[model samples]
Target: MTVNGWQVSGYTHLRELGSGASGRVVLATHDATGTPTAIKYLVGDVGADASFRNAFRGEAELLATIDDPNVARLYEYVESAQGAAIVMELVNGVSLRQMLRANGPTDPESALYVLKGSLLGLHAAHSRGVVHRDYKPENVLVTAEGTSKLADFGIAMPVGREAGSSVTGTPRYMAPEQWTGQAATPASDIYAATAVFYECLTGRPPFEGQGIIVLRDQHASAPIPTDPAPPPVHDLLRSGMAKRPEERPQPAAAFLDILEATAVAAYGPEWEERGRRRLAERAALLALLFPFNDPAGGGTAVAETVLTESSGFGGPGAGTAGLGAPRGRRLGGAQKALVGGGLVALLVAGGFGLSYASLEGDPVESSKDTDAPVVTDTPSAPVDPTTADPTPPLPPTPTSVPTATPPAPTASVGDTPTTPGRTPTPSRTPTRSPSPSPSTSPPPPPDVSPPKIGRSAASPTVIEPGTCPYGARSSTISATAEDDRTPVEKLRVRFTYTLNGATNTVSMFPSRSGVFHGVLGNLPYPKVITRIPVRVEALDAAGNVGAGTVIYVTLNNYCTPG
Candidate 1:
């Protein structure tokens, strides 16, 4: 089947992992290497645009450069006339957002473990001068082994550069300076990371506001919540999320020392190990909700083991088949009680008074209600997709809107209404003034339009294979791009051709002429006739994208008969 207008080639589509406005992530196996991977692709108009493709390529390039264990790895990036795709390491685990939603409020040890891993990852990026502008739970992935790694560097920027004028990032976790449009620094990443650490400990973010404007204000001046965590961990949260960037740790690496010290002092030397175990357990639980096929075909078996061993719900014969069974026959009394108790613990742990929006789908929106907390009920055992019963509906989650209080207007000094120096007559009856109502303007809708990519062309479209028998073949490819509003941020060209029995690909960057130029050398000597494929893309500052035409260069070579 075709995905986002491109034919599925060189890989087998396994199952969909998740989807968002930008695109969908899917589980797939590479045909050549037989390795499973998570492939993210742009969709519809965004995929068709060149600007988004450029951004996608940029992300790929950044990922390819980083080699930290706590960061997701990049495998391949494919760009063609039809679309663009990124092949990345498929993390065999769930996002930290999903973990918190499944089991509210991690213990202090576990919270520290998560933070330490995240910090290490952020430090790796910082050391490379890359700042993850969008650091949050959703971007942190916890593998089955309980190792937490940072994912989704789509909006990452260099350390010294400002991301942009428009505010970008989740409202609740943004740093104070980020709200003020300052350049993203390692300190900002630490701030956002600490916000997530607070969520892990308290089951909710540190601050709550009715809307984006208020949320920004809260981050700027709201008191850091440390009561959720023990006294020992308070300093870490405070210093990491200090309102002033100067007050916080300078680089992300510096905070690691403090965190480890605090963790060791409070939870002992083995606190990290304990925390990772807890995370692994949580990840195991999440697998039941979002099941994906493993390239090795044993993912389901391992999941069943984790479920039965951890919850003590099902026995050997009581396989996941019962998950699709009728609701009444699915769970026994003891199993039901265990599941119910777990849910209650989650609720109690999450009773921090602040509301939390579900982090399952796209970035949390300011307008969405955050009243009813998300709960992961006891689901039936996961059945094979082919033979599985129709999945049961999850319980309805409640939404709550915070009541907004308008600010009291203050009278300016010496501006009180008075007739010269005459005393005002006392009123027969005093009237009580009503409190001014708060304005309830909704945040503006996000920009979703893909950037426009201009048509591209290649010079000397035809090349004789024998002409480069002992040398290289060179060609210049050029393309332009524009966005409806934002300026074109980047443009890239991917040149792919088959040499011998393997495929070779190269990425080309743009020059001063607003055109991407590259030289393709070491072309295979054509035995008879051959064709090479090439594609170009453009990206806008906002990450909206578009692509250009796919062209092929024909090479003709023939040996003259003696």
Candidate 2:
């Protein structure tokens, strides 16, 4: 809640730390010490709910009383009409969950370091009769030095026999008792911590499924996955994930002891020394391994060094090394002679066979006779027998035919004509061989028209941030273009902003309205009103250029470029 222009009464505001469905966290300076603190202010209905308000008070009291270095210290609690706010020590770190999402699962050594730190924090909270019901990666923060701090103790409950019946912790990290609507004890927190460990090893929580209901079943009944964790860590996760609270580690201190023991067992003197030695060895091994690791390193100096210096040869000699003897040496005198002789014999045989085939075939005579006149100009004539025999295959030697013939004998009107001494020709008509029919179908048409150029509509105009009065911090610039000849199927919009001598451009496309919107993120604009200059152009469907217009518009005081 806001009070006296400060979010929450106990501190003065500096900046917003974070906002969530639960509440907003703002960076503030403590009134007495002037030190930076994160004030979590829960406004509206959360202040009205007795249970939610009690949760904030309970967490504040627990954090204020604790002396753990890993826990966020609560300085004070404030109640006002705007909201209930808790002022706590500000943590300078990114969340472990964020790191995991960005970098994937951590290596075993890194995971162990984080787990050990979380265990230390949990142990301290447990000693003071407070249970961190939500012990997931999201609640763990890691500083620049890799130091981990367990955070988000706003829902932590005091140790007691009786408990409320509402479900609180994230279901994916919740224990079986939590899913079954049972009280969340220290054992429940232990189960949640083990869930985080499983996530670290597998890159996912142990009970991920289709939905919340399916996940609850998996967490409540499905077997904990067999992790590739070391033997000691495996046992710790197994003990912490037991189905029943009584069956699992009963206290957070017990869980912490197991984690500490596992860390000590895993981080042996040899392993620690090996890790350090590996860093030192990376420099030398960079020569032998780097080039091989990257195949594209061929043109690089590293590849040249590996091939030349490492192989005891220079440049081209390195390429030929160990590739066997020269080509001339590999082919001996006798084998070379045999290969040449065989090639010559093959060529001679092929030539002879081709010549014989050409002489034996009658292709020339067949083509010449294909359209020979059957009856000359008179439309009737005797067929030549020798020519009709398909130009009998040529003999070994060429021969010529005699062209001289006896004159035809004169005959009476009723007598048949015949050659001089030959008998009258028999009355008979020669049979004709079939001729191939010519096709009557027409050939396909050719395309000869010139291609037309395609023109696209100009992109939509960009809407500048600070042009609109509301929501100036998160604003968008838009641009649009339309074509008269053809419908605009695709639109492209570009946005450019100049800040501090550097110009940044962003491009976007909108599916509807042929418009494009460019969103500016976290950009602070001038707080005084000024004109924003923009360029706009349009192209028709036929690619004909339309009007190009430069526009200047007055923007909200906040949108002017700094």
Candidate 3:
């Protein structure tokens, strides 16, 4: 009844597609146009909650902005006293996830086609200066016609906009910079695409490990593994997943050019047609599970196609098992897997090992361990879909935390949140260049004093209780950084904080004279009301760095008890 009654004005509910901690997704059709659509409904506590409502609206607005053949379109978002829901074009097909689970590795041409379609979708988003932060196998949907479309922009954000999330992507496909908690960029999307392509070429992701720490190290520092990919496409894999952003192709379209050339040369110009045929064959195998397909007796019910033992992306017991969630959960296998999208907090040790902590009713689990076809968004509330923003489903923190063990110590490398950019001038020779002319004047003694940085604090250190998984309200972070030689304007102050396992760094521009300020908002919600470890560092023109001592910021995550 909740599914049928949830408001989305002109759409008629056909069936419930999926449901999870975020909410329920239903298969619906337009009353006027008779076009099939997918409606994502946020109900119960989530519907009444302001934080979830805002995130849902935000994502809806994001979806409305792009119009691309390769990306699913947003029809509308609805909100009323009844509930909030997102209306989107219903692609009549199975998710690449389903296909991958049904069939092992696709042929080379098929993998190339997958990469091309995903890249084009990313190209459209990148044209708008947006980055699809979480691009993985599950996010790519393939229709019966063999066409692929990008799904789940729930975690996409504009370029250069950084959310201090623990880490906001599927680790198997995450870019190197994402592992270091850097903002998403066009290159980041390309890296993820290539990683997915690798998965299609081989049966598994390019880099696989037990946890995020190992994955993080591999993504950020390990050699880009090109050995697994077919020898011909090895170059694409290397360039796309390059450790540095600059090393990868510039925009999504630019990489698309490279992919086109590679495919044509390796598999001939008709490669896409062949690939699509292969993909269509794979989709045919799971035709019964497709939302548009109704079995002989009745409509498709989740129970009918409940993922069997070998069918789950995570194998068995991905959802409530291991996770200390309220035991006796009665959700079907598909429901459990689809609902397993919450992010588990990762504790980073000095040795790049994982240290997990216990969570309450709201647990965090690695999504890869419990992936499903559709990603139900985060828990959200009501909004006037006619005008409200969109949503971000649970910060793509797609898993519940594991055991009750103590979290590992905060990483000590907070002074610099990003990998050092380029080697420092390749080390100049000791034989210094001839003295500059009288006008140059010895470069003013090379600005020896690093900018002095003061302690940093976010105004309301406590995150709002209601912002469960999306993020905290915008809080202003202020710190003073001044250099004896460099003017206040010349000094750059960066505030770094490590929550869960990821490090978030914010650049504080000159607010006025001696002080620097930056607005901090939408931090991934903390599992416990503990302290977030942070520090402030400043850079001067001379490349000297000054840092403040590590400080603790209290997070009062006061919420309703179960």
TM-score winner among the candidates? 1
Candidate 2 wrong stretches, greater than 4 Å: 1-6, 43-45, 156-165, 228-232, 269-562
Estimate the TM-score for candidate 1: 0.51
Candidate 3's TM-score: 0.50
Give one digit per residue, the lDDT tens place, for model 3 in 1-562. 3564434544567655555444566665544333345666655455556654565555555666676878866545555555555655545455665455334467799999999999899988877765777787767877656788887665332222234444656777888787667767888889989898987886668777656577778888888788867898999999899999999997888888998999999989899998997676555444433323322221222221244554322122222322123221111122222222111111111112111111111111222222222421111121322233345555565676767895433433223334476332233235566987778445555567877877775644544433443223334456787788766665667788886788889766543234565544444556777677778888876888999877665655553221
- Candidate 2 lands at a TM-score of 0.46
Error of 1 at 225 (Å): 1.9
Off by over 4 Å in 3: 3-5, 42-59, 79-83, 156-165, 291-562
- Candidate maximizing lDDT: 3
- Rank by lDDT, descending? 3, 1, 2
- Model 2: residue 509 alpha-carbon error in angstroms: 36
Q: List where candidate 1 sits over 4 angstroms from the true fold.
A: 7-9, 44-59, 80-83, 156-164, 295-562
Predicted structure 3: lDDT = 0.59
Give per-model TM-scores: 0.51, 0.46, 0.50
